[model samples]
Target: MKLTLKIWRQNGPEEKGEMVDYQVSDISEDMSFLEMIDVLNEGIIDGSIDDKGNYGPVAFDHDCREGICGMCSMYINGEAHGPGRGVTTCQLHMREFNDGETIYIEPWRSKAFPIVKDLVTDRSSFDRIMQAGGYVSVNTSGNTQDGNAIPIPKENADWAFDAATCIGCGACVASCKNSSAMLFVSAKVTQLSLLPQGDVERNRRVKNMVKQMDEEGFGNCTNTGACEVECPKGISLKNIARMNQEYLKASFTTE
Candidate 1:
């Protein structure tokens, strides 16, 4: 199949960017979206598709194309990870588009996640948010509690597991009108807050992480629910509710 791709191109963080169009043919419907891009890059590198005098290959992030890493984040056709439910860009297939369709691709847009190049944004803001307090500080120096020793309710365990599935893909932010990271932060908070291992620092954890999230320039969530809808892992909006409750409780209890 032949297709037209209008992709964003930027040289560096401070450089101006714009949409550049290219044509690709003989694409397999079975190929993943990234694989299709690979074909385009190949054409560009070989000067076969060089209409704009060879701007080099498009720069997009990808690792573990199986969708486990969430690194293949792309805003395609105005939707995060393209037009799909519960799937990352790497998992998106070429068949989702018509044979002669024109696809528009861009990177995640947020102040906190500034673009490093074409289609590649610096998401280290997420890493910083996680570092603020997304883990348990339990002493495991031979005094580790046995996994079976903790009598956790199955309901809580399931909810925590669901929350833990968040891959930090930033779709939650990209889809939000405000570019909020609330859904991502809430999922991180819920995963730990529901578990016994994370009980020790619950109040402080919420306080620190939320503070850091704000410091990172992420916008506040106004319950528009876009984050929950676009999340590749389907992380629920309920986690945001839980996070709010935790934050309020932490404000009162945490010094």
Candidate 2:
């Protein structure tokens, strides 16, 4: 199928950007979104599509194209990861669009995720937020406690597992009107707070991560629920509620 793509192009974070249009043909419906872009880039590099000159291939982030990495983040047609539920851009298929259609693609827009180039944004802010707390302290001096030694409720274990599915894709922030990272942060918080293994630093983890989230320029969540809706992993809004509870308890108890 032939298609028109209007993709955002920027040389660097400080450089001006704009939408550039291109025409691509013979695209397979089975091709993943990133694969389709690969075809487009090939055309651009070979000077087949753009006759003016070699405009260079479009720059976008991708790793582990199986969708486990969440590096293929893109705002397509005004929706995060294109028009889909519980899927990342790498998992999105070209069949989702019709023949002769025009697709608009852009990078995640947020103060914390400044664009590094075309479709690639510096999501290291997420790495920093994770560094602030998203871990559990444990003793490893040959006296490590067995994780299975402590029996945990099935419900809590299931919830913790669900929260752990978050891939930190930033769809939660991209879809939010305020560009809030609450859903991502909350998922990380709940993933540990519900498990005994994470109990030791539960209170402190919430405090530091939330503080670092704010310092990273992420906006506050106002219960709009966009983050939950747009999350590729279907991370629940319940995690946010749990995070708030943990934060409040930590604020009062933890010095």
Candidate 3:
């Protein structure tokens, strides 16, 4: 298969960036999107893909390509995580496109996610929000109590588990016109707030996480619901509502 990739390239965070086109041929339909890019990068480094040697290897992020790590983030053909639903960029296969298609690839375009190089963006803003409070205050080390001791409702447990599946990929921000991270932040907030294990710090967690999200320059949600549609894990927008409730309650209760 052959593809024309119009990929975004920037030397550094402060540098001007532009889309550069390159043709990749002999790609297997079974190859994961990253593997196809590996072929292109190999040619680029070896000076075989471009006779003029103008192209350097493109830099992108990927770890545990199984779609769990959420490190492989990309804006493909103007869509977050490509055309698939509930799939990360690494899980995207070459077969999703035609043999001779022209694909546009880009990094997550958000002020919070500054460009690093090529198609890679700095997503550490998510980490800072996580550090702000996405955690349980309780210890899980020596003599941890049995998980079943709390007797949480099945519905609540299931909801918490669903929200915990978020991988912090930042696709939600990329997909949102406002570049809001409410979905990601709320998923972390809801996963903990729904259960007894996370109750001790629930109020504080929501308050601090939301505060850090705003500090990072992430926009406010306008209720457009685009974040839910593009999230690789299908993290629900209901988490956002839950987070708002948590925040509202915290504002009155916490000092």
Candidate 4:
């Protein structure tokens, strides 16, 4: 199959960027989206078409392409992770698009996620937020009870697991017009709120993480629900509601 790709090109963080067109042919329908991009880059690196020797390879992020890394975070055709629900760009297949189609690919757009290059954005802000307090300081170094030994309700366990599926792709932030990171933050908060292991430092974790999220310059969630719609994990807006409740409760309670 032959396709047209309109991809964003940027030299560096300080440089201006724009969409540049390229053509790819003989693409296999079974190939993952990133594989198709690799084919495109191979052509560029091989000097297949020398437009004054300036047509270079596209730079995008992908590691552990099994959809767990969340590094393949490009916006495609106006949707985060491209035309799919509950799947990252690496999991997206070429067959999702028709033959001879035109695709627009752009990086995650947010104040917190400044573009490092073409399709790569700096997501270390997320790391800082987690560091602020996304952990349970419990001591499990010695012989510990088996996970099943503590009998949590099935509903609570399931919800916690659901919230844990978040890959921190920032799709939720890119899809929001306000570029809010609330869904990602809320997922982290809710996963801990549901489990007993995470109960010890619950108040401090929520307070510090939320404070760090705001400090990172991420916008507020305005109930647009776009974050939930675009999240590759389908992390629910209910997590955000739960986070708000957690924050308010943390306000009145003293540790």
Candidate 5:
């Protein structure tokens, strides 16, 4: 198989980026996207790119290419993590593409997620959001309540678990026209606030998390489902609505 890659390249966070094209031959369809890039990088390492060293080996953020870590993020062929559904970029194999195809690879584009290099962006914004109070403040030593007797409403428990599946990959922001992080924030807020432990600090948690989300400079969500479609976890936009309700209610009820 042969394909052309138009990959975005940037020197640093402040540097302007552009797409550069390269063609490779005899690519195996079974090769993962990263593996194909590895092959391309090998060719690049074999030499320099003109006098500017432009065509050097490519760089992209990747940790655990197996898709469990959600670090392998890329916008391939105008889609988040390529055409695969409900899967991370690392799990995307080349089989999804056709021979003699031209693939456009770009990084997650958002002001909050500024580019660090060729294809890697600073995703620490998510960590900071979590730090701003995404978790339960209650610190349990040991021997809490009996799990079975908690009597957690089945609907609440299920919804919370679904929301917890979010892996914090920035695909939601990347694919959203407004680059909003509402879905991600909603997932965290919904997951925590739905439970009894999380209810104690519900008002506080929602306030801090929403504040952190806004501070990160992500845009607002107008109910576009693009984030849900691109999310590797298929996190629903319903959570965003839930978060909105929670935040508004907290604003009125909390001291």
Candidate 6:
């Protein structure tokens, strides 16, 4: 099968980027999109064509191509990752594509996640948000309570675990039109709100994280489920709603 990759190319952050086309022939339909790009890079390295040295290697991001890490992010074929409801590009298989297809690839385009190079964007904004007290501040004194001692309801425990599954991949920012991290922010908020260990600093966590999220230039959540739908973890938008309740309560209560 043959595929035409229309990929975004930019020399630097300040430079303008445009879509550049390349034809990939003999591509197996079974090969993942990243795998196909790898093959293209190998061909370029092998000097398969004259003046190949003039052509730059295709750039993208991917560490655990197994979908566990949300680091492998890209706008594939106009979708967040690809033609999937809740999946990352790494987990996205090539089987969903067809022969002689023209695939468009772009990085996570967001103000908070500016493009560093090709498909790689800087997501330290997320790190900073987490740093703004997304954790509990307490002595890890070896004298701790037993795991089963806390009688948390099954439903709450399940929700807490689900929220903890967020991989911090920044796909929520990528898919959002406002480039908001509300879903990601909300997930973190809910994860702590539902857990016993996460209390003590619950009020502080929501305030700090929300403040940092706003400072990062993320937009407000307007009930659009794009963030949750594009999230590879299938993070529920319900978490955002829960966050809204928390934020409202936190806003009125004095520390």
Evaluate all candidate structures by whole-model CA lDDT and list the values in order: 0.93, 0.93, 0.91, 0.90, 0.88, 0.83
Candidate achieving higher lDDT, 1 or 6: 1
What ordering of candidates by TM-score runs from best to worst? 1, 2, 3, 4, 6, 5
lDDT of 4 by residue, 6-74 (tens): 999998999999888888998999999999999999888887733232637888999999999888988
List the candidate 2 regions with Cα displacement exceeding 4 Å: 51-55
Candidate 1, 158-245: lDDT as tens digits? 9999999999999999999999999999999999989999977889889989999999999989999988888999999999999999
Error of 1 at 228 (Å): 1.0
The TM-score between candidate 5 and the true structure equals 0.94
Worst 10 residues of 3 by lDDT: 47-56
Per-residue CA lDDT of model 3 for 135-166, tens digit only, reads: 87777678788878879999999999999999
**lDDT winner between candidates 2 and 6:** 2
- Candidate 5, residue 151: how far the Cα is off, in Å: 2.4
Instruction: Rank all candidate structures by their lDDT, best first, as comma-separated numbers.
Output: 1, 2, 3, 4, 5, 6
What does the lDDT read for residue 112 in candidate 5?
93
Screening candidate 3 with a backbone cut-off below 3 angstroms (N, C-alpha, C), the clashing residue pairs are none
Extract clashing residue pairs from model 1: none
Give model 5's clash tally.
0
lDDT of 2 by residue, 1-255 (tens): 999999998888998988989999999999999999999999988878882323479999999999889899999999999998889999999999999999999999999999999999999999999999999887799988888998999999999999999999899999999999999999999999899989889999999999999999999899999888889999999999999999999999978
lDDT string for model 5 (106-190, tens) is 9998989989998899999999999998987666668677556888999999999999999898899999999999999999999
**Alpha-carbon deviation at 114 in model 3, angstroms:** 1.0
What are the runs in model 6 whose C-alpha is more than 4 Å off? 49-55
Question: Which stretches in model 1 have alpha-carbon errors above 4 Å?
Answer: 51-53
